[model samples]
Target: MAALAREELALHKLHTAEHYVSKAGLRETTDQIMEAISGVKAAVDNMTLRVDRIVENQAKLRTTRS
Candidate 1:
């Protein structure tokens, strides 16, 4: 499930980045550039949450074993 979610999120990021780039005027459009940065921030956030879940599961397994 996590793998699938990660793949989907990755795809979304790719599409979003492309869309931002296509709209951003070269040497201009600071606002669009900032928006692109925000998009990347969101992607990072999504990946971080996924990693946190994986770490939590590992901790639970360790406790269960001991």
Candidate 2:
């Protein structure tokens, strides 16, 4: 009976440790995904600014031609 109790306690501790390790891994993954998303958003914003500048320049050229 004492051996069985000791085994059960060890199993419970192992499971708890595994749970925390899994959560830590999940948190790291989530952080990496968020960083990637931020990078993409920055790229898109930069592209938008470039397009706006092109459109403005085109408009200026049209007015000058008229």
Candidate 3:
């Protein structure tokens, strides 16, 4: 009976440790995903600014040509 109790206690500790490790892994994955999303957003914003400048330049050229 005493041996069985020891075995149960060991298993419980192992299970708890696994839970914490899993949680940490999930958190790390979420952080990486958020970082990637931020990079994409910054790239899109840069593209938008470049497009706006091009449009403005084209408009100015048209006026000068006229």
Candidate 4:
């Protein structure tokens, strides 16, 4: 199975505890955490794509200069 991310792990621990946990239940916490993870993953993906594009552009520029 895939490993849970840090935020997901913390949520799971919070839900499992007997008392003083966040008012949000497991499903709600899970949903919110998933949304956060999704946002972070999307940002990372976008950054990766942009970096790749930049690298390609640099290579093209270098080749043109040679």
Candidate 5:
């Protein structure tokens, strides 16, 4: 029947649209996760830099005292 065929076509189109929307949402979530990881990496790098400076200063003090 023509009516049944038309209904099936509509449902197929709706299903396809839903698939694309879900894919886009997944991409957005992945991007947010990557951004958060980047932020944590930056923070860790800053701490490492500070610790290096502290160690260097201590080494210099030890040499001066000797």
Candidate 6:
């Protein structure tokens, strides 16, 4: 009857709210993971540049000695 309909409506609303909350949590986690990946990429780029400079300097020293 009417009481049963009301209960069903309430349950539907609760499920909808839970779904949104779960989606929001997943979005936040994805954002955090992307930020971490960006930070690691920046660090790797910095290390590569430093290594290249070191190698170039060593080559110059070898040429001067010869």
Model 1 over residues 1-66: C-alpha lDDT tens digits? 999999999999999888766534654678778899999999999999999999999999999999
Report clash pairs, candidate 3: none
Residue ranges of candidate 2 with Cα displaced over 4 Å: 1-21
lDDT of 3 by residue, 1-66 (tens): 999999999999999887766768889999999999999999999999999999999999999999
In angstroms, the error of model 2 at 54 is 0.3
lDDT of 2 by residue, 1-60 (tens): 999999999999999987766768889999999999999999999999999999999999
Q: TM-score per candidate, in order?
A: 0.56, 0.68, 0.65, 0.65, 0.68, 0.67
Question: Which one wins on TM-score?
Answer: 2
Residue 12 in candidate 1, Cα distance off native in Å: 45
Model 4 per-residue lDDT at 11: 85
RMSD of 1: 21.9
lDDT of candidates 1 onward, in order = 0.90, 0.95, 0.95, 0.88, 0.95, 0.95
In model 3, the runs with Cα more than 4 Å from the true position are 1-21
Candidate ordering by TM-score (highest first) = 2, 5, 6, 3, 4, 1
Model 4 lDDT, full chain set:
0.88
State the lDDT at 35 in candidate 5: 100
lDDT of 6 by residue, 1-66 (tens): 999999999999999987766768889999999999999999999999999999999999999999
Question: Which tens-of-lDDT digit does each residue in 1-66 have in candidate 5?
Answer: 999999999999999887766768889999999999999999999999999999999999999999
Residue-wise C-alpha lDDT for candidate 4, range 1-66, written one tens digit per residue:
345687798887887785655657767889999999999999999999999999999999999999
How much RMSD separates candidate 2 from the native structure? 3.1
Which residue runs of candidate 1 sit more than 4 Å off their true CA positions? 1-28
Model 6 lDDT, full chain set: 0.95
